[model samples]
Target: MTDTRRGSIQRLDNIAVVVDDFEAAKAFFGELGLELEGEATVAGDSVDRLIGLTGVRSDIAMMRTPDGHARLELTKYHSPSPLAGDPQAPPNVLGAHRVMFAVKDIDDIVERLRPHGAELLGEVVQHENSYRLCYLRGPAGILVALAEQLG
Candidate 1:
């Protein structure tokens, strides 16, 4: 880690996802309106080399949201391994995680994604904090959330 000055952190840059097929993952996310930013390889000695006795030299894809701030990075390990999927339980399960996006028209967005093959996980609920939210499983079991904060 670099020893930088105080208040060095300005903002969030990106999020990453490891995918088996780069083109397919990009296509899936592209349908949701995120644009492809670029692609690259994790080339360096300092990175991990062995995963369950398999070598690790992988290619990756980087994508960005429409606003051009947050990012989605997809990486695929060349070696075979157990497939990745949603945790065998609800979001309350330990270590379970999902990405949340604040949207203006949650209902409209939900409707729009139906034709693109998104599965509605649950009905939108009004929370105690004046928030309306819902869960949807998008391409490749990706858990996406839409939230409208009334607070």
Candidate 2:
């Protein structure tokens, strides 16, 4: 049998995070070092149908790392409202709960993000011959892991 494959996958465009405060979420990611790429409002039946929500309207902010290869989309739904979740949910709870980023200096980054209300979920720990990693609870209780490579 011959191998049959459709269009090849290009690259990951962005990760979407639904938040209650669009501007605050944008600022959180920005303080964490992601540059604001752009922001816009999305509506219409097509969007609603696509997201499986009726009368859905949202404001979205696109954030990108300095390298420009990675992106994060922060969205705030204005119609049909949004729901609240356990912000402090444990890691084992499942679903897409966290995003990890490689950083040059985890400690420094953590310090800088403190004023923005970024709290370390636990102490930063060094993994044997791999990395120094720590989980941070950022705006809206978004969990972000920071990894600094070891020499």
Candidate 3:
């Protein structure tokens, strides 16, 4: 069979999250095990035009997952400052809810992230015999979930 979605779209480059505390957000994801691929400050007319904003100046940290299949881009705006939103917005709120990662040890990951200000939204629970999962709020109130496969 032919692939219906072959050329319709390519891979997802990354998911960008804007934040207030740039360093903290970077550290949070770093502690979660994402490697720092690179960092740069973006500006200029091209950037403003692309994002539909004026005088845009933002610093970005590109984080890569250990498996190299995914990336999370954390952005901190310097000029034309970022707007404030509900940092503690519940999962029921609209828009992109949470970003999930497949972890090897759910409990250990959760415990390690605690000092970095990770707050569990609920206790980790097993789903049948397939996996264990939990949701937690990280820096800038970004919701993240972890799942560990079971044998």
Q: Total clashing residue pairs per candidate?
A: 3, 0, 0
Query: lDDT of all the models against the reference?
Result: 0.72, 0.88, 0.91
How would you order the candidates by lDDT, starting with the best?
3, 2, 1
Candidate 2 vs candidate 3: the lDDT winner is 3
Candidates in order, TM-scores: namely 0.70, 0.93, 0.94
TM-score of 1: 0.70
Off by over 4 Å in 3: 1-7
Best by TM-score: 3
lDDT value, candidate 1, whole model: 0.72
Best by the lDDT measure:
3
lDDT (C-alpha) at residue 18 in model 3? 89
CA lDDT, candidate 3, residue 94: 75
RMSD of each: 4.3, 2.4, 1.6
Tens digit of lDDT per residue, candidate 1, span 76-147? 766445367663346676666677777777888888788766777889998997899999876556678889
For candidate 3, write residues 1-151 as lDDT tens digits. 5569757656688999987888888888998899999999999999999999999999999999999999999999999978888888999987956889998988889989998889999889999999999999998889999999999
Clashing residue pairs in candidate 2, if any? Answer: none
Model 1 has a clash total of: 3
